[model samples]
Target: MSEFKQLSRSVQGLSVLVTGAASGMGRATARVFADEGAHVAVTDVSADGAKLVADEIGASGATARAWALDVGDASAIDRVVGEVAAHFGGLDIIVNNAGISVRVAIDDPAYEDAWARGIAVMLTAHPRIIRAALPYLRKSPCPRIVNIASTEALGATALHSPYSAAKGGVTSLTRSLAVELGREGITVNCICPGPIRTAITERIPEEHKIIYAKRRTALGRYGDPEEVAHMTLSLCLPAASFLTGAVIPVDGGLMARNA
Candidate 1:
């Protein structure tokens, strides 16, 4: 029994929906899910980028598709959730990886504006997806929902108020939902990553990036896309089924340091 458990592909033949699938952690996660024999539907604001990933998955003979979606719109989220569920018969997993970042100081007057925009995409949109998919997820034997967050959920960022606040909401929402949905067989958890190289992080001033590399992380290095992708797969598996409402940090020992 233990050997069979060790060799089992927990996600094989499951249908997965991954947001922000055009690039960064989301893209990496989508590919990883497909590699594990899950049919994946990739969604992002970038149609071209999402289509490119879908095409790659298709070329590998995996079931995949892409949709251009603005996570800010609840109706749009509902539409895509319904579409994916209908396409795949039922949605066994939902990876809420779509998010937006805004660079603004905490003391800035425009912080409210920046924070609102970030919330629209990062924090607000995820519930729309869960609400829309609850029916389909309830039908599945094993249901998983993974929300991608950031180290900013724990550490403060002077120049990233909006991004930090949004991610903080994600961390909170994960715990809240876990308590509410645990008995229903839907597992909810958040992965708070630190200093991942992505399109959004490239905009960070190099000097500041290096400073971040030096200060926050003990390893003094940024994590790779694959590392975060592995975390995503781990969260949705049956082993993690009993692990709900936990904030799993995949950062390279960043949370351990007092400095």
Candidate 2:
């Protein structure tokens, strides 16, 4: 029999950075990784919220730390990424899950501002974070970058041009970087979450949410944040080495439905 080679499916002892981890999918992602034995950096613009998540993870006997990070601030991004790498001693994976809702007509006076902020947080921050973490990530056995896009990147909704544009950019960036970093064994992937319950969607009327899910999703129900988080985790596994540049939709089959 040929010798069997071993590959790792675990992320234990790996250092992972999850942006916008105070609430929603980001928070769920952090918890999932911590549960799996990875050292999680729960960062968000909301310092208290970030601390709360880290505290919760610590209380669960998992490894985690909180950092006040505003993804839109370039200087802060550099500083925080450096601090996270320094504090953790090494960084392996980055989940760019920070995002904002920017709903405005192209003709609106605030359209430009909305577009700039949305792009800065959702699209631009991905590259900045990746670049900053490259030194550490390059030194790790498994270097993974997961950029959290949205189904809006594939299908757009009215009044969400900025959000859609940024997400689209993220998907593109993921593909381009995956190709560019392939030779180095670094995996870059994008996830487009369809209709997950998050802080952004909290204000939607429950009846409307149900109606939309029934009409638009194959599963006829909204997905949970952990569902998406698990997908993120799967891509970061060292055994997933062959998979890269893939844009996955964790929307309960929303993208599979057509009416």
Q: Which residue pairs in candidate 1 collide?
A: none
Count of clashes, each model: 0, 0
* Regions of candidate 2 where Cα sits further than 4 Å from its true position: 1-4
Residues 1-259, candidate 2: write the lDDT tens digits.
9999799999999999999999999999999999999999999999999999999999999999999999999999999999999999999999999999889999999999999999999999999999999999899999999999999999999999999999999999999999999999999999999999999999999999999999999999888999999999999999999999999999988888777
State the lDDT of candidate 1 residue by residue for 1-259, as single tens digits.
Answer: 4555553447889999999999999999999999989999999999999999999999998889998888888888889889999898899999999987688877888978888889999999988889998999999888999999998998876787788888999999999999999999899989999888888888878888778888878888788888999988998886776779989888878898788
lDDT of each: 0.89, 0.96
Model 1 clashing-pair count: 0
lDDT of 1: 0.89
Residue-level error in angstroms, candidate 2, position 136: 0.5
Off by over 4 Å in 1: 1-9, 106-109, 205-211
Q: Which candidate is the best by lDDT?
A: 2
